[model samples]
Target: IRDFPTLMTKARICDEDGKAKSSYYKAMNDKKGKGLDRGKPYENKGNGN
Candidate 1:
């Protein structure tokens, strides 16, 4: 949940029309565990730093 803002910001960098930003919020607020607030710890899929 806390990362949503940063995610939206990064998304906006790729999509300047704000489409990704809007969708991101929608997904985060979505019901069930399908949203960003799925109550799971974030996993870093990137290379371990």
Candidate 2:
């Protein structure tokens, strides 16, 4: 689980859900660096893609 301070930090950095999604996709698509893989799909269980 994530720590409360970390969650608070993210909340401060990403003011809206759209900003958070943008940051997430940017990190995932990064290459020649610490990019994450497009791993197995799972139930979103929440709004948006």
**Number of clashing residue pairs in every model?**
0, 0
Over 1-49, each residue of candidate 1 has an lDDT whose tens digit, in order, gives 3789998887777786577788878878775476665554656556584
**What's the TM-score of every candidate structure?**
0.29, 0.32
Clashing residue pairs found in predicted model 1:
none
lDDT of 1 at 27: 78
User: Model 2: residues >4 Å from true position, as ranges?
Assistant: 1-15, 31-49
TM-score, cand. 2 vs. native = 0.32
lDDT, residue 43, candidate 2: 56
Question: What root-mean-square deviation over C-alphas does model 1 reach?
Answer: 18.2
Please report how far candidate 2 places residue 15 from its true position, in Å.
6.3
Collision pairs in model 2: none
